[model samples]
Target: MGKPFTVSRETIVLAPPEAVRGLLDDFHAWRAWSPWEDLDPDMERTYSGPDSGVGARYAWDGNKRAGRGTMELTGVQPHRVDVAVAFEKPFPSRSRVEFVLTPQEGETHVEWFMRGELGLVQQAFALVKPMDELMGPDLERGLANLKAQAETEAGSVA
Candidate 1:
């Protein structure tokens, strides 16, 4: 046994909290902003449960970079969403995913965070360096993409 490992990352989207929350609540919407989706264009996706909110589950199977995993929405609120993801195939691990939205100057400050206990193999991989370092850039890019899409949508509506 070893200490549990965790990483947290956040970004501000130039849109209202409601708008940002709407985007995050819908699993299918992730394709618009998730950097990982670009890793496997041919990845297979499946969704079950509700269209959004708690009980919603989405699974993906793709190449090594995208891996294979299932994420289920565990909690949802006006400005936040929580999910649990279990990876399979290439590696196995479970992680808790969260999205927190706070209104700031008419824009939404979106913080995406994940935490989980690393299995022996994952722990060994982390020894290479801080996981946050590898994940932060991807998180930033995803947020940036979200911001772009949200702002574009807002502009179109206005």
Candidate 2:
């Protein structure tokens, strides 16, 4: 087996840690800001466990780009969330998702990281094309959306 690989992207949002943390807490709320949601608007989705906490799971089945996957909240901290996403279609692999929030000059710096085990198929695909290059843009878009949403909400509240 090859070493585990990771892809990470982050952005600093102009909001407080608590507000940004709330956005990360609810998987359903992700529709408002996640770039993946835009890829397959008709994807089948299901939620189980708590609305926002450890043990919560969000599963989806969609077209090729969206793929089929399940993401479960596996860990949590005061301003962090750790999720594991298992892809079942288009390819199969398990990836870890992490959200970290740090206070900076009254705003929050949010960092999102994803690391995982690449299956044989995905590794093969990566041989021809790097997944990080293909997926980094989407990650950036997601972070941008998150930043916008958090900042907008903070502005409204203040």
The candidate scoring highest on lDDT is 2
Q: On a 0 to 1 TM-score scale, where does candidate 2 land against the true structure?
A: 0.93
lDDT (tens digit, per residue) of candidate 2 on 1-158: 75577778888888889888888888988998888997787999999999988998999999998999999989888789899899888777788889999999878878888887767877887888776886788889999999889889889334
Per-prediction TM-score to the true structure, in the order listed: 0.92, 0.93
lDDT of each: 0.83, 0.86
Task: After superposing candidate 1 on the true structure, give the runs of residues whose Cα lies further than 4 Å from its correct spot.
Answer: 156-158
Runs of candidate 2 with Cα error greater than 4 angstroms are 156-158
Where is the poorest 10-residue window by lDDT in model 2?
1-10
Report the Cα lDDT for candidate 1: 0.83
RMSD score of candidate 1 (Å): 1.9
